[model samples]
Target: MDLAEMIKILDRQLTTEGRTIHVDKAKEHMRIEQRTSGQGVSLSLSELLRRYHEDGEEALNQTILAIDRGLHAMASAPHLKGKESKIFPVIRSASFPDHTSDGRRLITSAHTAETKIFYALDLGDACRLIDDQFLDQEGLDEQSLIELASFNLSALPIKIKKDVVKNNTFYFIHTNDGFDASRILNRKLVSDMQAKAHGDLTVAIPHQDVLIFGDVVNPEGYDILAQMTMKFYTSGTIRITMLPFIIEKGKLEPIFIMANKRPMPGKSKR
Candidate 1:
């Protein structure tokens, strides 16, 4: 019963049934398959502890492919994107925009299938043509992408200078739902031909992909919680994904999370 022992038997069957765990219905009961050798599929543990004892563990701990052997140990590591520029660990997908109650910011999907996973440092070949157009492998050119993902030919240091900020603040952890949850959780939505081809005309708000994990001397924010604990509670789902970067001067960046702070080494043995 992987997925961290079916979230410890669905957090002891939702603490003996008083009911409360609903991280988006445990991320909508988790699921993912994608395979053909690009390496995918894993996380069974008797069907995720019988669906987390029939549903709970925050409703089911959604995505990262529902953690089955931690998404086949991150799609089978050692792919090392051509072996260099280390600091791997990724997995992303995000979007924003969908507001109202007077602020009006359309473009909705009611939150596009969220997903997340940090840690980076692979500048060396800018992800080899998007991992050869979706992991068919082979692509790192520019001088073998600086002899394999740069930054001193990789031993993990693509560029993670500004240190330590555990759980720095990547949250979609919702439940209140009365609206104005910080402007509908930081909304977003552009696409009027991509916001007038980048001029960003106006009125298209609602953007919720937060992460405030502080550092440089406890700048604040901290809540590295990957929680799950359930067992029969019904109607559950939880999903929060935001992994895409490019915004130079307002912080809110991406990649770089393991200074060996620990807890990732085993990924619960696949």
Candidate 2:
């Protein structure tokens, strides 16, 4: 199927089934980074290029496809069981003290009690740490890092608030860099939320892709397209970067919305 149909299916699964592969990807990625100590076991940029160069695009693409499928399956798995094979009292009893059978039960109970903490530290912290490392390379600086860390610290509580939104609720993430835009724009699943784009700035899943709400801008001096908008849906911490040249030259800079009102019923999602 084409990307549009694939995205439509994903969207339907999210809205109607109360399930989404996207969330699964997030969870699977979380687990992988945790397992790898925050450095993903997946291929790096250099490795990906080398694979492509030596094996050809088909081989490289297949590798990526397999990874994507793994992520999807990991995300889609409905059940996960965590183990507690180490507790101090149990370990001590088994190795040295030879404590009573009741002591084993107590140790097991305690280990079970700490599941939330263990999961939080292992799953949440690992994911955020690894994601932050990547985002920093993508464009985040020190201040943005701090802000995102704060957001991750509160992610659990915040995710609850996020869950209350209606099924059709949309999200748009805009960044000042065109590279980031290019990286994500091809994913129709995300781009559907976009309402506009200018230059390096691109919108996701606009209700109308052809009837663009904003014009594209090719800004000079920087190798990028630049624009801004306000209609973006924001549920978590958002990092905004105004292009440096725009700031230095005291230019007004193009502004655009991140999100827009849903198209009228029967209107096509272009």
Instruction: Report how far residue 18 has shifted in candidate 2, in Å.
Output: 13
RMSD of 1: 19.8
lDDT of each: 0.28, 0.25
- Predicted model with the maximum TM-score: 1
Instruction: Show model 2 residue runs off by greater than 4 Å.
Output: 1-41, 78-270
Name the lDDT value of residue 8 in candidate 1: 55
lDDT of 2 by residue, 53-91 (tens): 555656444544444443443333221123111101110
Provide C-alpha RMSD values for all models, in order: 19.8, 21.1
Q: Candidate 1: what lDDT?
A: 0.28
Model 1 worst lDDT run, 10 consecutive residues: 225-234
lDDT of 1 by residue, 1-270 (tens): 455555455445332222233222344342233343322222334545565566545435542223343333433444545444453332233432223223433222222234222223333322211232223344443344333322332232111112233423221322222111122222131121122222111111122212211121121211122221011111222223222221222222332223442222211111
